[model samples]
Target: MLALNWHRPLMLLAVAMAILTLAAIGGMTIDDRTLTGLPIWTKAVKFALSVVIYSVTWAWLIAQFTRWHRIAWWAGTVAAAGLGLELTVIVIQIVRGTTSHFNFTTPLNSALWETMGLSIIVVWLATLVASLVLLRNPTSDPARNAAIRYGAGLSLVGAALGLLMVLPTQSQRDTGSAVRGAHTVGLPDGGPGLPILGWSTSGGDLRIPHFIGMHAAQLLPFVVIALELSARRIAATRPVAVRTALVKTAAAVYTAVLIVLTWQALRGQSLMHPDRLTLSAAGLVAAAATGAVIIIVRRRPPVDPATIQPTRTAPGAIR
Candidate 1:
C-alpha cells in the first residue's frame, strides 16, 4: 500500500469546501431564487464541490513528492488559499443575489470579479510550480508517473482555456452591456442550458472544454488506478510497460478530444448539435484511441510460465 502524506492546509480547505457544498445544497432547496435560469445557489454548490475535489487532489499529489517537498507544500498552500478566496467571493456574490463572474455592473462587482481573476491566476501558477516539482521527482511506478505528469500538464491547459471566456463578445461590445464576458458563444448567457451545469444548449458553451480539461488530473489518475486493479485479475495487463503505454495513449486521445471540443465550441456549435466536421474529428480521435488500445494489448509481453505458482494438492485422498 502506498503511504500518502497529505498537506495540512489543502486538506483543511477540502474540508471547508465539503461543508460549503452541503450548505449550498441546502440553500438550493429552500431559496427558490433563480439566476441565469438556474437556482442562485446552484453555482455555489458546483464550485464548492469542484474545490473539494481540487484541494484533495493537490494535497495527495503534493504528498507524493520525495524531493522539493517544501516547495510543493508551499505551492499547494498557495493554491488552497487562492481557491478559498475564489470560493469566498462566489459565496458572497450568491448571498448578494448576483453573478460572481464577469459582472462589472458596479465598482464592487467589478472588484470582486477582478479579485477572482487574479486569485485564479495565482492558483494556476502555484499548480504549475507543483507540477514541475512532481516531474523533477518522479515515483518508481511508471504508470503512476505518466498519469501524474500528463494529468497535471493537461490540467494547466484546461485552466488556461478559461481565459477565452474573459474576452468581450461582439454583442457585448455593440450593446455595451455591464457584463464584460460570457461562457457561451454566439448566444447570450441565461439562454436554454443543460440542467445542473447550466452549459448553453442553444449554442457553443466554452465551459464544456474547460470542465473537461480541468478534471484531466483526476480522470487520468483514476485510469491508472483502474488499470492497476485490472492487472490483478487480467494477466494481459500485468506488465508495467503495457500499463504506462496505455496511459500515455489515453492521455494523447484525451488531449485530442479536448482540442476538438474547444474548436467546436469556438466555432459556435452547440455540443448537442455537432456539425459533420466536428463529428468527423471526434470519430477520428475515438478510432485512433481504440486502435491504440488493441495494439497495446496485443504487444503486451507473454506471461512467464515460471512465474506461475502451482496449486497445492491434497495429501491423502487425491494421491
Candidate 2:
C-alpha cells in the first residue's frame, strides 16, 4: 500500500484547501466584482482548487519516493508555505476588492503582488527540485519509471510557463505599460472569456498549456497505474516492457499536443481555430503514438496461463 506519512503536513493543507474551495463556491453566489471582470470568488476558487490538487499530488508522490525523506520535508514545507501565502494574498485582495496580479497602483499593492510572484517562483523551484530527486532515484518498474520521468519533465515546462508570463510582451512594449506583461494574447486582460476557465476564445491564451502541463504530475501517473491494473489481468512476461513503451508513447503524444497548443496560442489563434500547421502537427503526433502502441502490443510476450492467478477466491480470501 502507498503510504502518505512522509508528507502529512501537506496532505492536511490539501484538506484545508478543499474546505476553502467549498467556501469559495459559496462565495460565488454573492456576485462581487473584481478588476478582472470576474467574480472575486473566482480567483479564490481557482487557487483553492489548484492548491488542493497540487498539494495532494505532491504528498502522494513524496510518499512513493521515500528515499529522500529529508529533502521531501524541505520541499513540502516550501511548497505549503509558498502556496499558502499566494492564496492568502489573493483572498486578501478579493476581500479588499482589488486586483491581485500585476497590480502596481499603490506601493503596498505592488509589494503584495511582487510577493505573490516570488512565492510562485519559490514553489516552482521546490517542485523542480523534488522532480529531479525523483528522477535520480526512480522505481524498479519500467512503466512507473517512465511516469516519474515524463511527469516531472512536463511539470518543469509548466513551471517555466510562469516565468514566461512575467516577461513583457509585444503588447506591453507597444503600449509602454508601467506594469509587467499579461496572460491574455491578442486581447486585453479581463475581456470576455470562456466560462469558468476564463481563457480567451478570441485569441491565444497562455493559461491553457500552463493548466495542462501543471497537471501532468497527476495525469501521467494515473495512466501508468491504470495500465498496471490492466496488466495484472494477464500473465505476459513482458508486461512491464509493453507498458513502458506505451507510457513513452503517451508522453510523446502529450508533449506534441502541448507544443501545438502553445504554438497556436503564440500565433494569437483561438483554441477552436487550428490552422494547417496545427492540424498537421496533431496528425503526426497521433500517427506516431498509434504506431508505437501497435508495435509494442504486437511484440508483447505470449500470455502463459500457468502464471495467471486463479479467478476463484481462496477460502481465506477477504473477498
Candidate 3:
C-alpha cells in the first residue's frame, strides 16, 4: 500500500479550486436573458461555487483535525442548523411580502444576513476553526512556511470578506433604515447603469455587496493559488520545468483574463461613465496584484522539492 503524504491535501485543494473556477465560468454564462429562478447560468454558478467552496472548507477542517470524532459531529450539527435557519427566515420573508427574490428579496438578503442568514456565519466559523486545526503545524508554521500561512490567512480573509457582504453595514443606508420594509427600498427606475454588483436599479441598492462579492472572486482564488504555488516543489528535477510553467501561467493566463476584464471595464460607450476609471484601472490593479503574487509564490519556495515527494501513494495519484 502507498503511504499518505503532502500531495493528498494539496491535490484536494487544487481539485476544489479547479471546480470553483469552472463554477465561476458558469456564473459568467449567466446573462440578462430574464428567466426566473436565477438566470440558469447564475444558478449553475451558485450551485457549483457553493459545493466547491464548502468542499475546500470541509476538507480543510478535516485535514486540520488530528481527532475527528466529536468535531465532525459538531460540524455536522452546525451545518444543519445553518441550513434550517436560513431556509426558515427566507420562507418567513417570502410569506411576509418582504421581497420577490428578484434582487435579494429573501430574508437572507444583504450582508447583515450572514449574522442572521440561517446561521451561515456560525456554520462557516465552525468550518473555519476546523480547517485551521487541520493545517496547524507548530514546528513548521514560520514565515518560511508561506503555503500554510497563506492558505489559512487567505481563506480567512476571503471568508471574512464574504461574510462582510452577508452582514450589511450601516453605512449603506441610503433608503429608510433596514428596519423599514423591503417595499421601501428598490431599484431606481433609471437603473444607474449595469452595476458590478448590488441592486441600485431596484428600490434598494447593493453596491457594497456587489463590490465586495466581485472582489472576493479575484482575491481569494488568487490567494489560494498562491499558497498552492508556494507549496510546490522546486527541486533540480522540476526547477526548470516548474519555473517555466510559472512564468507562462502568470504571464499568459492572467494576462488574458485581465485583458478581458479590462476590456469589459473600458468598453463603455463613453469614458465618462462613473465607474469606468475605477473599473478599468482598479480591476487591472487587483488582477495584476493577484497575478504578481502567484508568480512570486511560484518562484519563491523554502521547501525542498525532494521533501514534497509522496512517501505513500494517494488515491488520486497524478499518474
Candidate 4:
C-alpha cells in the first residue's frame, strides 16, 4: 500500500460533503415535498455524494504531485471551494422550495443559478490546471501514470458536458418561459425517470453521460489498482508493459463509451430504450475492446523456465 499525502483542504471539503449527505438523507425521511416529480432532497443527496467522491479523489490525486506542488495545491483548493459553494446553493434552493439549475423565474433565483454556473466554470478551470501539472510530471509506474493522465483529461470533457444543459430547449424558447433550460432534451424536466437517480426514462438526459465522464478519474485509477492486484495471481498482468497497454486499451474504450452516450442523449433517446443504432455503436466498441484485450494477453512474452529455481530437499533426509 502506497502512502498518500492527502491534501488537507480537499479532504476537509470531502468531510463536509459526507455530513451534507447524511443531512440530506435525514431530510428525505421527514420531508414529503417533491421537486420536478421527485423528492425535494434527492438532488441534495446526489450532489453531496458526488462531491464527496470528487473531493476525495482529487485530494488523493493532488497529493501525489512532487513537482509544482504549490500550483496543484492551489488548484485543488479552488476546486474544493467552488464545489462547496455549488452544493451550498443547491441546499439553499432546496430549502426555498425551488429549483437551483436553469432557473430564472425571479431575480434571486436567477442570481443563485448564475452563481452555480460560475462556480462550475471555476471548478472546471481549476481541474484543467491540475491536469496540466499532472501531464508535466509523470509517475514512475506506467499503469498508474496512464490512469492519472487519461482520467484527468476525460473528466474535463465530462465536466464540460454540463454546459449543454444550460441551453434553452426549443419549447422553452417558443413559450418564452422564465425557466431557461432543462436536463431532458426532447421533453420537459418533470417526467418518468429511474428510481434513485431520477434520470429521464422518457427522453434524453444529459446528466447520464456527464455523470459517467466526471467519475472517470476515480474509475481509471481503480482499473490500474485492480490490474496491479491481479498481477499477484495472473502472470500476464504482472509486466509493467502489459499493464500499461491494457490501461490504454481500457481508456480508449471508456472514451468511446462516453462518446456513444453523448450521441445517444443528443438524439433525444432514453437510456432505458436505446435504438438499434445506439446498440450497434455500443456493440462495436465492446467488440473492439474485447479484441484488443485478447491481443494484449496473447502477445505477452512467455516466461522462461530456466529462471525458476528448483526446490531444495529439506536437510539430508530427502538427499
Q: How does candidate 4 score on lDDT?
A: 0.92
lDDT of 4 at 314: 78
Name the regions of candidate 3 deviating beyond 4 angstroms. 1-52, 55-64, 67-73, 91-97, 100-115, 137-152, 162-237, 240-319
What lDDT tens digits, residue by residue, belong to model 2 across residues 1-319?
2334648778777878889899988888876565676777888898899889889878877777757767867888898889999999998988888888877768888899999999998998898878877876777888888987898789779768766567777877887776666777777778777877888878888888888888887899888988877776754424777888888888888888888888888887778777898889889888888887778888956678999997898899898
Clashing pairs in 4: none
- lDDT per residue for candidate 3 within 1-319, as digits (tens), equals 1211212442343354456557545545644432222232333344334434554444443444445535654654465456345544443443343432223434455433444443756766765665454545432323223333344444444345333233323333554444322211222222443332222332333333223333332343453355346556534224433433443343344334433433332232222233555467656666765775466545644677877876787899996
**Would you list the C-alpha lDDT of every candidate in the order shown?**
0.92, 0.81, 0.41, 0.92
On a 0 to 100 scale, what is the lDDT of residue 42 in model 1? 94
Per-candidate Cα RMSD to the true structure, in Å, reads: 5.4, 7.3, 12.9, 4.9
Candidate 1, residue 89: Cα displacement in angstroms equals 0.8
Cα deviation of 249, candidate 4, in Å: 0.6
Point out where model 4 deviates above 4 Å.
Answer: 1-5, 301-319
lDDT of 4 at 156: 95
Q: For candidate 4, which ten residues in a row score worst on lDDT?
A: 1-10
TM-score of each: 0.92, 0.87, 0.42, 0.92
Candidate 1 differs from the real structure by a C-alpha RMSD in angstroms, to one decimal, of: 5.4
Error of 3 at 87 (Å): 3.8
Q: Per-residue lDDT tens digits of candidate 1, residues 1-319? A: 1322488888888889999999999999999999999999999899889888888898987887789999999999999999999999999999999999999999999999999999999999999999999888888899999998999999999999999999999999999989999999999899999999998888999999999999999999999999999999998688998999999999999999999999999998899999899999999999999999999999957678999999888877665
